[model samples]
Target: MTKPVRKAVFPVAGLGTRFLPATKTMAKEMLPVVDKPLIQYAVEEAAAAGIEYFIFVTGRGKHVLVEHFDHAFELEQLLGARGKTEALETLRAAIPAPGTVISTRQQNPLGLGHAVWCARAFIGEDEPFAVILPDDLILSDTPAIGQLIEAHAKVGGNVVATEDVPREHTNRYGILKVQSDDGRLARADGLVEKPKPEDAPSTLSIIGRYVLDATVMDRLGSIGKGSGGEIQLTDGMAATIDDGVPFHGLRFEGTRFDCGDKVGFLKANMAFALDRPDMRDDVAAFLKDMAAGL
Candidate 1:
């Protein structure tokens, strides 16, 4: 039997240069989507998928991300005293069990592959692990990672969440060279990092959620700089493909918001806020007025 995916790695070390002043003092993952931070949403998603170990690959100035997962005694006490039961419960539930959530620093601002490599010691020689980029916020009835985990159980190999992109947008993503497609699962023969639209094999692009085998760590170790002179995750994954490991792209069930982009971030805030019972009416009205004014 294949080992269950017990651990998840969150690479939250990226500098949100696009958000500028807002991210100057805080980590990009600390930015709010609605009421919860992006990193919090990612952690909650992982937990919902039955992930036991949450390993955060952090960088300088990401202490706020670390503190968010910890209990706030004074705040909790204050909320309890004020008879705010729901708020208190929410706060308490945010914290993982002791030692369940741990952080390791990446030191340098390398690419996503290098960030995952930083967490190798934590993963050790254990079962397959997950890597989630908080910037790619997926809203679905079933968490995106849960979908990939389910596929991993069936496929028994590396599983990456994929979604179809316009052919013109191929250069913006790691394009998939699909060997077989059954709609939900695509057997991948190769992966191209940001290929030109004309050169793209298929428009099915790799998203942020990944359930990868432990051997990928070894592949990443041997992968030199790729694409943008960084250790691209696509390159490492392709190496596994060449070694005869079964790799697949799972057409995940969700709506993904690229929170790293300015427009996408704004859209996520609006969409999530509008989903809230308390804020829906107000946000809708505000949007109507703002649009009319324009």
Candidate 2:
């Protein structure tokens, strides 16, 4: 039987240099999309997908991310005193059950693979785990990770979320060498990290959501620095495919926002804000007026 993906690891150790001035004093994962932090959206997605354990691979100055999940005794008391029952309920609903959320230090800015490897001790052999890069926020009727988990149940191998990218943009993503395309699921024979458009095999670019077998940790164990001299998770994933393990690409149903980029962050703010019941009308009208001026 395939092991259920019970735990999800969040790679939140990045320095967020792009959003420097704001991130210089805070973790980027704490940056808000609409209202909730990026990390909160990732956690809620995992929890909704039946993920029981949340492992956050953090670094120095990431205490704020940890505190976000913890109880605010004074704040809760103040809300109670003010008869803000709805506010208190919202806060309580956002937090996971005690003992389910834990943080571990990554201590270095190695790369995505290294950050994931940092949490290997929390994942045991014979168990499958999920990794959510909080920077890639997805809005879908079914949470993106949940979509991958559902696909994992059918295929029973390492499953990654994939989406088509423009030929000119293939260099920005890890492209897949697909063996066959079966509608939503593509059987991949190989994965190449950021190949030039001319050298690319297909446009099925890998995204941030992944449901990986624990054996991926074993492959990552020996993966040296790749591409930009950082331990890339794509390198580790490719090793598993090379070893003859079944690899699948799930064309997940969602609108993904690359929140790590400035343009993408602004896009997410506008998109999510426009989706909110209270803000949609005003935001839409403002956007229309702004477009008219442009």
Candidate 3:
């Protein structure tokens, strides 16, 4: 029987070096897209997917990421006194219910594999879980991670979100070797971490969302450094495949923004703002006028 995926691990330990000065003190996941931070979007996606236990793998100075989900008593009191019902309600809505959120520290700047392994205790030995990278902000009618969760329920093994990128850009992602595919779902024979264009198996590249079995934690525990001399999560997942575990990739319906990039971050802000009913017209008009100027 397929156990429900109740927990999700969020690796928020990255030193957002790309965003430099702006991220010097702030967690990169804390960077805002429109009114909500990137991490908040990820949390909402996980929540929408029915994930109840949020396990955040944090680093030094990443306390704010956990705090973001906590209650702000002073702010709430002030909002209540000022009769800011809307803002207060919004803030209250964002807070996760007590005892549902938990966090663990990843002391070293290890890779994604290690970050995930840090949350092994939170995810027991036999339960399946999800790992969401806040860097990839996916906007979809149905939550992107929820799509993967549904696939996981059927596949009962492991499922990763996949998208086709240009062959030239294959080296930027974990490329999947498609054994068989039926349009939306592809059974992966293998996964390669950031393989060069000539070495890539297929153009279907793994994205930041994943619904994985707990056995992956066992693989991640003993897996050695791979690719760029870091403990790559792709390497661990590949090991699971080697262990005769089934792995599949889902071509989820979504528009993804690589929020780790400056251009992508700016584009996400514009896209999300345009998605709002209140801001859509004003943002659309501004964009049109700006385009006319260009």
Off by over 4 Å in 2: none
Tens digit per residue, CA lDDT, model 3, 30-149: 998988999999999999989998999999999999999999999999999999999999999998899999999999877999999999988888899999999999989999999999
Among the numbered candidates, top lDDT falls to 3
TM, every model: 0.96, 0.98, 0.99
lDDT of 1 at 244: 88
- Model 3: clashing residue pairs? none
Error at 280, model 1, angstroms: 2.1
What lDDT does each candidate get?
0.92, 0.93, 0.94
* lDDT for model 3: 0.94
Cα lDDT of model 2 by residue, 1-294, tens digit: 687899999999999999989999989999999999999999999999999999999999998998999899999999999999999999999999999998999987998999999999999987899999999999888999999999898887799999999999999999999999987899998888999999999999999999998889998989899988888898898898888778999999989999999999999999999889999999999999999999
lDDT for model 2, please.
Answer: 0.93
Model 3 alpha-carbon drift over 4 Å, by segment: none
- Cα deviation at 50, candidate 2, in Å, is 0.8
Report clash pairs, candidate 2. Answer: none
